[model samples]
Target: MLLPRCHRIKQPASRSLFQSRPAGRLFIFMKRIGLTGGIGCGKSTLVDYLIGQGMCVVDTDQLAREALSPGQPAYDTVMESLKGACRLEDGTLDRSALGHLVFNDDKKRRWLEGLLHPVIRQAWESRLHTWDREGCPMAVVVIPLLFETQAQDLFDHVICMACSEKEQLHRLLQRGWSQEHIQQRLKAQWSLKEKMDASDGVIWAEGPLSSTFQQWDQIYHRIVSP
Candidate 1:
């Protein structure tokens, strides 16, 4: 976690017009990095490390949860659209029930995505732009479905977490998901290799998290270096 000082904060050659001056600080390019991977692939660990290093992050999962809370636009929309099918006895939306409904049917999955993705995307992108305007040097957006959602254009760089299938299943099992459930989730998204191939950077996560951090540190310097 010992990242060197990004004193110079150089921009990559391909990026354009991100450099902005802020009083006495070094000119920093507004960086919006997308962090993504399969479920339980340690994106949270990386996000914690980024926060520790003073980077702002928008967690789309958190935003999606907020959207489902009562009085939110998405909550009202779902009730009107789905006719309370996802509702619980106490009147709260049954998240587990909704999840089960979606995971089994491609139509349901697309319907849920259609309901929530736009709101979540706008929320995070607006936050990132606001931070950039306020002189934040860099920010991260943790989107587990970044590729699936076709949101790669929203970032200056996308860093994907890659690991063996065995490791991915092991981590999910630790979270109490069954193998059948894991398979369902996996089938819905691009494989780890495909994500890595499409990403600007990949953090190989077959080993310890410190190793993952080490890779990020290297990518950090590479992306921000002269």
Candidate 2:
């Protein structure tokens, strides 16, 4: 089902993601794809696979992490906003502590998003522009909250990685997350069903690793070959 469910590259990426950039920059439009899903849904694995296939991938989570690292502009802003609530002894952000802070308090989470989302989006958009100018054929941006953040415009096609909630919880637990921690994080994002319904294609991430990846490989070939 996953292999047969490939969605082709759609035309006219949402302009909202790059309205600020100059127009008519690229002779050939770079095929931009958005990869999104719930937390612990094997997005990293898919990203690696895509990267091995020579795709330029922009992982927004990694962007966010780098943005909030010590000495970064957003790092200063977060520390100032949180009054140094979860900083480490080395003056870097204590992400685990910060996660606990934001996950438990909706207000703080929203505030953090307000501060982080624009910066991350701008960073990736700039990269997309770069790739297009460089004549890159295709690129993927991994944004877990693509639909929730209204960032679908950032890509020509959107793909969702989905597995059962039980499988999701199991994956998180393997990562040393407590049941409560898993629940708290999952509650913040749209459910797998909702994401899959909204995406142009869905990668049902169940069963063996090879099986999951075979699904993604088919979708990739369809997008790039079509």
Candidate 3:
């Protein structure tokens, strides 16, 4: 399947302080594992399971949020580009508002990604470097757009979490997402089939939580012992 041209690396913006670096060359000592899946696909559940087992988890979603906070790296640029359409009266970013605009428009979505991905990658690389220096064995990075951003090369291993389409839609509905909104978000990502095909491992997130836990346990042991 042909991915959108946005999935490929583009020329760097000259004024941006953050730049993408090759993860493989930057952190050779630590085992870096990338976790990704479609929206509502239970990637977070797997991330939490890994965290409970004492792995350091770097969440790109969280980092992106931080990057957009008032004084952070991406804040000023976002405000300037979005022209206050996604900002609150009190000067905070209205995430839901921004999400609505971007999800419905491919150009806007790619623009936002172009603004944020470099900053996010820089932050993730910094954390990985710190972990390596501190003698950490492995770190799990939760990036929802790992494959879309062509970030699979950044990790020693990559895991794609997935479930049936029915289950995915149901889960998103439970979280108060409208069916249309969910579909739009899903459309922005690589299909689960493609992600699973490209990944080093796959975790089916269909069944009960205990079943998911058991699958995670097996993967954990394999990563640690193999």
Best by TM-score: 2
Highest lDDT among the candidates is held by which one? 2
TM-score against native, each model:
0.85, 0.88, 0.84
Q: List runs of model 2 lying over 4 Å from the truth.
A: 1-27
**Per-residue alpha-carbon lDDT of candidate 1 for residues 1-226, written as tens digits (9 for 90 to 100):** 1111222222344765535455655456687788897777788888889889888988998899889988898898888877998988777788877777789888878888998999999899889878977877778899999998999877778888767777778898997878887888889888777777677877876677788899889888876663
Q: Residue-wise lDDT of candidate 2 within 60-115, one digit each (tens)?
A: 99999999998899899989988998888899899999998899998989999998
- Residue 121 CA displacement from its true place in model 1, Å: 0.8
Model 2 sits at a Cα RMSD from the real structure of 4.0
lDDT measured at residue 93 in model 1 versus the true structure, 0 to 100 = 84
Model 3 worst lDDT window (10 residues):
3-12
Of candidates 3 and 2, the better by lDDT: 2
Ranking by lDDT: 2, 1, 3
- Per residue, candidate 3 scores C-alpha lDDT tens digits across 72-166 of 75889888887878899889899989998999999989999999999999999999988877667788899999999998877767877788777
Ranking by TM-score: 2, 1, 3
lDDT of 1 at 15: 61
The global Cα lDDT (0 to 1) of model 3 is 0.79
TM-score of 1: 0.85
The superposed Cα distance between candidate 1 and the true structure at residue 52, in angstroms, equals 1.8
